[model samples]
Target: MGQMRRRGTVAAGIAALVVPLTAALGGATPAQAATSCTAGVGPYQKQAEKFLGRPVDGKQSSTDCTSIRAFQSKHGITPAAGYAGSVTWGVMNLMNQQKAAGKTPNKAGTCPVNKGRIACVDLTRQLSWIQDGKKLVYGPVPVRTGRDKYETRTGLKKIYWRHKDHVSSLYDVPMPYSQFFDGGQAFHSVGVSMWNPPGSHGCVNMTKTDASKYWSLLKTGDDVFVYGRKPGT
Candidate 1:
């Protein structure tokens, strides 16, 4: 009788564990599960895929969203949460439209200088590019320029200094991958939303990824041109 009771107790315990395990297994999908973006095959997807070096199949598959997020991360888009929503689509569309119009995809009118390697900042377009004469090296990359009160100075300048890991003496903030051009202003990586309203304070903010790339492509004394006004000015 005692043996029978022990067996029954063990069976009950095993059943309880099994029941909860089964329930958990049947619960909602894991957070790491593949995410399917619903934006579908459209202009946004087409351009995004092209930008991401993916096949332009016009399908918003899980792979597409992943590639879009990768691009977002490179260009300073906030969240980089793998969703090609309004901001992502808007930027991509603008780039595509510009390309279709036979203009430099990210050029704000024209190249500020017509010479050697230069970093071009078009505040009007909130985009930056690195070019060697007329040959494009990188960009039309989304950037955040200074806000209204502390507007980024517009004119031709040159990168006079560079700091792989710099800290602002006035702002008391870290400025990584900093390349100073005008006064205390610089082009550096900032952890803020590039698409949002309130902008930076006399600085050209880029994504960490872009900043790193810029560091590699530019050197001290490289020409830096700040022109045009930011969109929605």
Candidate 2:
């Protein structure tokens, strides 16, 4: 078994690609299939339909529920009942925004340009990337940051430590490519999907590939600029 582990489950993150839902769903869609799903119009029915490419009629239908519920289940959202509530819509909304974020996510100039070889973490977009004096060095990949009470602190920090096979001292979970920059908070790879609900315990969770890339691209004393407030936080 791989050492990588999330606090809850791995089915939603990288492992999801290994298990295709095609055969089980009769080739419907990994994110839009099921025999049973919630019924009735949800609070964000129209918005969900727009995001999922479903017919944009405000009323909820069986097909819409199936699609929405599948998306919920895919992202590890609670209920997975296709309610199209604020929580579900919120996730979809962020995804839509991310898609709109084209080549330059830092075009807003929020991250410091003077910092050489710095990692930029935008909690509002739930994305992270590296830059070398205005030039994009690495990815603008999705990430999972600390939620609610355990919010990831916003400010500039430096990677103080690293451990390839680090295990969480408090949660007892494997945190691969762990790079600590703040107290109990690091950029590590977890099994949970970046879009998974609630969030991490004040750590910046990445995919194994992303974390590995980050590990190779970043080093001790590398500046990490974190800004913006995560929605619902």
Candidate 3:
């Protein structure tokens, strides 16, 4: 599976998915002021400072705000207001765990290795990747999956449809690079940060770049294995 484009016939007559009114729209909550660092010390200021390698003083300094804000912005933490609250702190913790995984994200052997070409989604860590046997094909990029009641269904499935430029019939939001692997719970690129809270209605949300890469790399019938439970949901 050396980057070969395997074209397969698309499944026709698949019902257009209508997600819940709460959140099928990918860009429903865009962080507009992600760059503006606020002026106050957050509840987790000291923890954030330590995580960012800044001074361990509990007070919020200008430099600390800027650094914490940068981390929040980079990870798509909401408000992006430079506050080191629990959400920001939680994301920092996740990043630390992922960093420890390094190049071999599948070291835990959760994802099936025998599948020729498969998409591996680790909902527990909110990360995804493409693999060709033992070779890592695409990324172990950060992702946003379904929230609470609409949790992304786990188990092995195959890509049944591919809609490069898709708009939700119900939500009317753009779902770019949409590839339906499990009913309405497709893999699509959204406009918000992958770390955005409460997650999607059911879809696996990816960044624009990551979704585009997946669209180019995978095709209908490709294996998609979603495992583990998302942190909150």
Number of the predicted model whose lDDT against the real structure is largest: 2
- Across 48-143, the per-residue lDDT of candidate 3 in tens digits comes to 888767789898776677667666555567776788888888876665654555557788888998989999999887778889898877677778
**Superposition TM-score, candidate 2 onto the true structure:** 0.86
Residue pairs with clashing backbones, model 2? none
Candidate 1 segments whose C-alpha is farther than 4 A from its true place:
1-103, 106-109
Which has the better TM-score: candidate 1, or candidate 3?
3
Better model by TM-score: candidate 2 vs candidate 3: 2
> TM-score for all predictions?
0.57, 0.86, 0.76
Whole-model lDDT for model 3 versus the true structure? 0.75
Worst 10 residues of 2 by lDDT: 1-10
lDDT of each: 0.66, 0.80, 0.75
Q: Residue 14, candidate 3: how far off, in angstroms?
A: 38
Please report the TM-score between candidate 3 and the true structure: 0.76
Candidate 1 has what TM-score? 0.57
Candidate 2 per-residue lDDT, tens place, 88-186, comes to 889877776665554587999999999899999999988888899999877677789988898999999999999989998798899999999987899
lDDT tens readout by residue for model 1, 72-160: 55446666655666667665554443334232643444765466898888776677778887776775566778877889999889999
Off by over 4 Å in 3: 1-43, 69-81
